[model samples]
Target: MNEAEAAVLIALLHARPRKMSWSAIASEVALRGSATALWDECFPPTLEGVNDLDGHLARAWESLEAWRSEDFRLLTVLDRKYPSRLREIHQVPPILFVRGQLRDDEVAVSVVGSRRASDRGRAVAARIAEGLVDRGIAVLSGLAEGIDAAAHTATLKAGGRPIGVIGTGINRSYPASNRALQAEVAKCGAVVSQFWPGAPPQKHSFPMRNATMSGLGRASVVVEAGEHSGARIQARLAVEHGRPVILTDMVVGATTWARDLLARPGVYLANSTAELMDLVDQLTRTAAGIDDWSNVLPDLVDH
Candidate 1:
């Protein structure tokens, strides 16, 4: 693996996934490229609590070997297989462990919400997911409780490829209840994690995982979120990455941020997938920019 890729997996092992800042990571790579270019070239290093570079490198190597043996595959930012949309995000994960198939569908949308979603929120998410999937648009979300779970299930129920990006390890599901859903995702779509196998779900992992959800999608539809929710953070990240943020007032009583997001200059306001599908259809027609990885490392393969 390249140094950046190694660093990213190491960072995940370090439990400091969010610490892989763009400028700092770019500095580490020694690549004379733009921040976006550098992000596309390096993996987020997981070097938590290591004061010495040598010690960090040593721990990273050990983590790499352990991850490799467990069938955990790494897709470096330099890899051609890296998602183009995700590469656009500034806080994107440098290295991702993919457990299943990742489709090259042109239109991908993330459906996100609170972990403790209301029944109405769950129904809406499922409905939105079904509508998107029926149009051949890929549904992406965190495989969490409530709305996220509803979205993934609806997509699979519609016989569509639904991508589930998680904060926990691919081998273990957080909340534990979604284990079967995780398996279905691996079978029908993909179960992706920046965290290595056996990595615990720490408090910070949730927000860190949100960037992946937003980056992987052309637009994100947030059905519900509290004032300072991770879902809300993801909506902002989507805007930062130049993807449209679609806000839905799923509940009768919604926060000011939700209303404000709806009124934002570039953010799209949608109450249902029918309204959002037009945007998905529009984005789906665009061709992905070709990104070749052959020049980066020549021939370095790591699981």
Candidate 2:
């Protein structure tokens, strides 16, 4: 389909991410003459032809207007400016609400760990963020309290970009404490979310946030996590998304969950920034041989 046609279908699919797969809905939109025709076919028919969807459409326009006023861009899957890495993943969001500008050919590396980070964990997380950003990578994180915050701060300190994939809506900052940091990331890099304009931080939102964070990156680095930490969830999601997951020494040697991860084919253990960078290089080189991530397509997601 043409880009505009595809984006309209993508925007429609956002309402039913799991219920409507791209290939299933694409056939209908692709053959339709225009977006208006496609919408007519999709929206349930009503006696007056007005339908209840007009309400939804009105609210959406309001949201778009709010986004415009704030200069936050809403990226559809087929939009040229959409993050390519995020497009090629299972359950990929059809819409991304983004604050700040996306750098040309941006490459993100997710750095995750426990929010209640140990001293060493915080230090290592910052070191990894600094190392990755120095190499021209955007350090992607959840913008949580401890390790995520440290990594973002270090990336900024190193004069590098940092993308915060937050769980809350683009309009509201989670933890409330990271409000300034959230604004800073938008200035220096981006603060992104798949949630709606005013969605609050629900407990269940973060597991999905982890997957979104994983999809934004070429690879993921788990600097520290207790056995049941959310960082481990992100690492697993990274592996499932076909991205390499780098586990720190503390996690690899101590956590049973991480031991299983280390045994996986694409997972690696790194004790220092040097080792982490080496693994990142190896994984990137391997990925480069297989796919052009910049030209990612919808079919590439489910494959």
Any residue pairs clashing in model 2, and if so which?
none
Residue 133 lDDT in candidate 1:
82
Q: Write the per-residue lDDT of candidate 2 for residues 61-149, one digit (tens) a residue.
A: 55555555776877755556766776667757656788997753767889999889999989999989888877888899999998999
Mind giving the per-residue lDDT tens digits that candidate 1 earns over 1-303?
465455543543353324655424533432443223333333333456433343554677676767667755777665667776665666767667888878544567899999888898898899889888888888999999988999999999999888998998778897799999988988888889876567899888887898888878867888877887778888877766766666774631477777666544446555555665655554454424513211222222110
Top-scoring candidate (lDDT):
2
Candidate 2: residue 13 Cα off by (Å)? 6.7
Relative to the unseen true structure, what is the C-alpha lDDT of residue 174 in candidate 1, on a scale of 0 to 100? 75
C-alpha RMSD by candidate, in order: 9.9, 6.1
lDDT of 2 at 294: 26
For residue 112, model 2's alpha carbon misses the true position, in angstroms, by: 0.5
